[model samples]
Target: MWFFIQAALYDNNITFSTLGPPKFIDRQEVPNVPLNAPKPVIGLDASTKVATDAFDDLEPEMIYLPLSAYSHYRLRGRSQNYPLLYEYFDINPYSGKLETSRRVSDLSMLEIVTGSMRPLHTGDFVGLSLKLVYFFFGILLSMMIFSGMMIWTKRTYKSTQTLLSRSTKAPSKTTKPEPSV
Candidate 1:
């Protein structure tokens, strides 16, 4: 939950990257991009124009960027107030037109590393490890919940039985006073 909500509650933009350097950053590869290439994928401003490719518009200090948003490449963007996220685009290669863009998030790491263990996606041996991990997680969670409930129920039942037995106990004649009208 913390990791899930942290993206929203906290404006922690991934400024520094440790993945590696971009494919082509040297010599300023000014792409012949469309004016409407840069779109707001996550936190980028809509008014942000392409301005002769995104690489040219970036700050001098900011050069290196990760690859493929769909495959775990998150690059920071320039913003005035809040932290901004960049959407890396795929080029048509032939026509040099922007094909599509995707927001690079941490979840992409899973796909890159394990390729997901959800059985419905990967092969028998490829994602089987992740599938087993998820299965164990579910079993562990169920066991924890069941054990907690059992403990609570036992404590409650014992307490109730003790009180009931005490109340239902037969009283001695001397201790048994006359009933009030």
Candidate 2:
């Protein structure tokens, strides 16, 4: 059908969102600052050491996706092309520390660039499949009910006509010879 062809070939117009830091504008924006900025100060002092009681009032950032090699991001480090993504905490709350670190390290070591372009996942497939299955089943059920009702009404009308004919013909058979005399 024309509708099906259009639906199958139509652009889904999928929207993708990224949780990483914004792009850096310039290298010499700040005086005495390296081109690659340091990690966010998470209760750390000037010596790059964690400050006392820093975690007592930890305000975590909001993260939606699971931490993975695809989500690991980094900047160029001192004497290195890019700092390890594990230098920062995984923004995802559900991620285990070891798993998060491992994913970050794997991405950084292999120099893989990851972003929102990761292919649509299993959840998307499952959801679409369910929607289509339910839609077809609903259409089939509606058609079946409609055809069944039509057939039932037709059979009922034929039965009523047969009953009326039998009752009317029985009386004519009993009054046979009265007109002959």
Model 2 weakest lDDT span, ten residues long:
43-52
RMSD of each: 14.6, 17.5
**Pairs clashing in candidate 2?**
none
Per-model tally of clashing residue pairs = 0, 0
lDDT of 1 by residue, 131-163 (tens): 687678779999999999999999999999999
Q: Rate the local accuracy (lDDT) of all candidates.
A: 0.42, 0.36
Model 1 regions more than 4 Å off:
4-7, 10-89, 93-126, 170-181
In model 1, where is the ten-residue run with the lowest total lDDT? 43-52
Best by TM-score: 1
Best by lDDT: 1
